[model samples]
Target: MKGPLFYAKILLFGEYGIIKDSKGLAIPYNSYQGALKMSENPSDVAKKSNQNLLKYYKYLSDLKTDLVHFRLDELKRDIDGGMYFDSSIPQGYGVGSSGALVASIYDKYADDKITVLENLTRDKLLNLKHIFSLMESFFHGKSSGLDPLNSYLSLPILINSKDHVEPTGIPSQKQGKGAVFLLDSEITGETEPMVNIFMNKMKNEGFRRMLNEDFAKYTDACIDDFLHGNVKSLFGNVKNLSKVVLSNFKPMIPMAFHQIWQQGIETNAYYLKLCGSGGGGYILGFTEDYEKAKDLLKNYKLELVYRF
Candidate 1:
């Protein structure tokens, strides 16, 4: 038996800035997805997944929140029956791989689970995020819950602050020359270490100033420009955001790509920023001319996301 699939998600204009209550936007990525399944004869991979699920089941059973509840007995039954999560989403790639798993499990096992079909009011959205935050923390050690919220609803989410979230609509993709793409760094990024670094950096008042004044400003502008279809303004803000990230978020970026990241802004071929926690995985790129960016950055693998 298999359950409904949950797609991966991309945070288009939010990363470190969101932690400070900056406006953030996230969209579902249908290219990768996952679901819960049970097999009569489980493979080694499935057996491993089954074991992980049992541990996750125990974690859920210990959750103390009154916001949500799980059908723990049924979940335990399935875990005993070799139920496992089979997924195509790449882990540690910043594309919500674990988030999809969390969402799918919540979909099937949560008692009085929030249904996507219902009229999703603002309060309902925030409640869902709160629940997901608690549930997904088992994986990340700390979670904002935005990732699972986006995957569970399979809709674009706008994060106004830590406590305020809402469903949002982005401008339709256009058949034009500009595009957003993903550049594979080919190295896995650990969320905990990266977050730890950010926390340490937060101790510096100068870093805090840069984050609040420069990073947040540019990120907010980028989100507004993208949602409003202000192509020219979006690229402008993206360039600024890229520069800020390159200078301030150096540790999170893989060392090999530093020159390339600089070259993008210098030549206007593209603007690159962190897709998730940075350090490695996929780096998000925005280009006013996709063909030109492709030619200039021919040494790396690029996956097209959206076209302008």
Candidate 2:
């Protein structure tokens, strides 16, 4: 059986801000996607993925009814029928691999699943977030539910505040040297430990202040600038955001990329930031000149996302 595919998502402008009701934006990145399928035979990865999903399903089943809702029996039946995820998205890469899987299962099995075709009002969106949070908590210890929501909706999600979000439009890309790209670390990174580090660091007043003031400001500006096609302003905010990430999120950066990160800041050729809870995995980069950035960042793999 073939099921719908859900693409991976990227929180381009918001990382930690939207958790505090700050403005944020997310876009669907089609480069990676996952789908549910049933096969008589399965590979090791598929077997492992399905086994993990069973554990997740059990967790969801055990959740208190008052806290969340879903149709668990249908999910069980699908699992019993050899239904498993066949996906190209890499796990531990911060590209919503698990999130897409979770969303696909929920879409297929939940009795009262939110239909993307229905009137997706603000209240509905908020309810989905609450439900998705409970559903996805099986993977990440904590979840905003934004990744799964974006995967489910398959749209660019804009966060105006904690209580408001909707599909958004981005400007058409133009051919140019400038780009937003992903650099592979060729290793997997765990989200829990990185998130733990972030939570621990939040205890520091200085870190909290920077997150609230500088990080939030630049993140918000970048979202606004990108949506409005303010290219000049977007790059300016990206540069500052890159700097803030480099200064405060050292633990998240892969060790080998440290010099390249610094070189970007010093040369203004490119700036890199954690794609998602980086310890390894992929790091996102913004470059005014992709060729130069690629040359300078040679010896590593790069994938272009968008052109400026």
lDDT top scorer = 1
lDDT of 2 by residue, 1-308 (tens): 89999999877877767766788788889999999988789888778777877887889878875634677887788777777888998889988887898788778877667789999999888888777777888888998888899999998899888778888888889998789999999989998888889889989999999999999999989888999978888889998999999889888887787888889999988888778778888898888899999998898899988899
Q: For candidate 1, what's the RMSD?
A: 0.8
Write down the lDDT that model 1 would get. 0.93
Q: Which ten residues in a row have the lowest lDDT in candidate 2?
A: 65-74
The numbered model that scores best in TM-score is 1
- Report the C-alpha lDDT of model 1 over 237-258, residue by residue, as the tens digit: 9999999999999999999999
Candidate 1 worst ten-residue window by lDDT: 13-22
Q: After superposition, how far is residue 184 of candidate 2 from its true place, in Å?
A: 0.8
Q: What TM-score would every model get versus the actual structure?
A: 0.98, 0.96
Query: Considering only N, C-alpha and C atoms within 3 Å, which residue pairs clash in candidate 1?
Result: 252-279
RMSD of 2: 1.5
Model 2 spans > 4 angstroms off: 66-68
Error of 1 at 255 (Å): 0.4
